[model samples]
Target: MAVKIKLMRLGKIREPFYRIVVADARTRRNGKAIETIGKYNPMQEPSLVEVDSERAQYWLGVGAQPTEPVQRLLELTGDWQRFKGLPAPEDALKQAEPKPDKKALFEAALAAASSEPVVEATTPKKKGGKKADKAEKSDKAEKPEAAEKAEGGEA
Candidate 1:
């Protein structure tokens, strides 16, 4: 069975307490959990999030996926980072700050476009539509005069 690390609801109506657990993906929201790894209490001021980093990292490393809100909780504990082996938050900020030059980006895009063969559009254009209509009317007017002359000559 596909496994997911998600929440199990435990508290009374409108007063919610969640157990962050590793459970089968097919199970109901508060069903039998394979293992409880953490707890989340949003009712408290500043919120309370307690997660076992080692257990969380282990479950994530072994392919147990966390649900959206659970993923955010794992991020709070840095369990997600530890599982992925990313350098700590401070180092990540330093690496992320340097923006690429716009000129370099534009030149790279231009080079790629130049490498590809250009394609001409094959759809017919409507630029000459009015002129074509006028030409058709002129041709029809000339045809009737030519037909009259031919009939007069036959008479």
Candidate 2:
């Protein structure tokens, strides 16, 4: 059976978690996984990723393919590097090059900021007026005397 390393989406809406698994390529996205190799939580600061490098390398050697995103995660964790061998000298040389002039960059940013038009930070007048109207209507709808009586009775 053809196997793949991929992510299975979990958690609630707006908050997502993923499990890295080795599964039959034909299985549904979140269906029966053959083995859970790791997990990733993107909600945390810096994100959290845990992978089993030895198992991952073994699977890759055995011809299990990793999906693109999972491949990136593996690369970030350096597991892929170890499996594929170190990067070429050309890549290392490119990274070793000196950074551009910071003073020039700062001056350019200052010029851009000065050229940009300043705008008030307040909400747009139309939306602000409508929101205020809604708040006033809601406040009028609620009986303060009734609220006071409820609080007084509770006390």
Candidate 3:
């Protein structure tokens, strides 16, 4: 039978926590798991993640596949690197404590959302003009060129 290393969602809506578990692939997400491997609380600042390294490694070695998010959590906790025959828990702990680049991530998301090209204001450029003048210039510029052409034809 196929086994999975995945997260089981818990806690209230908007405030989510999870259990890292080893379970049969057919089991429902929050159903009975074969083993509880750890806990994850994304609600907390810095987000708490605790895992049983030995059990996690054992499960992986025996062919349990982790879901994408679970795999990321494992990487953050250094479980995958350790399981892949790297350093021990102490070294992993040392490496795991680095601060996440939240500001850089936020800026990257903002940049992605604003990726479309933006047009410059078509209004006459104002030099040392008050807000009201700027508004008037914008209103004047917004008049369609077709309106100007019609006015000229009437003349």
1-155 per-residue lDDT for model 1 (tens digits):
78999999888899899999999999999899999998988776557788887888888888998999998777777777777887545422112245789999999999999999998789866768889999999999999999999999999
| lDDT, candidate 3, 1-155, per-residue tens | 99999999999979999999999999999989999999999877668889998899899999999999998888878888777876644433332466769999999989987996887898977666587888988888878776889999999
Model 1 residue 126 lDDT score: 75
Better of 1 and 3 by lDDT: 3
Candidate that scores best on lDDT: 3
What tens-digit string does per-residue lDDT give for candidate 2 at 1-155? Answer: 89999999999999999999999999999999988999998886657788887899999889999999998888877777777896622222112245779999999999999999998968655656778899988887787877988999999
After TM-score superposition, what is the CA distance of residue 58 in candidate 1 from its true location, in Å? 1.1
Error of 3 at 116 (Å): 61
Per-candidate count of clashing residue pairs (backbone under 3 Å): 0, 0, 0
Candidate 1 Cα misplacement greater than 4 A, ranges: 90-155
Task: Provide TM-scores for the models.
Answer: 0.56, 0.55, 0.55
TM-score of 2: 0.55
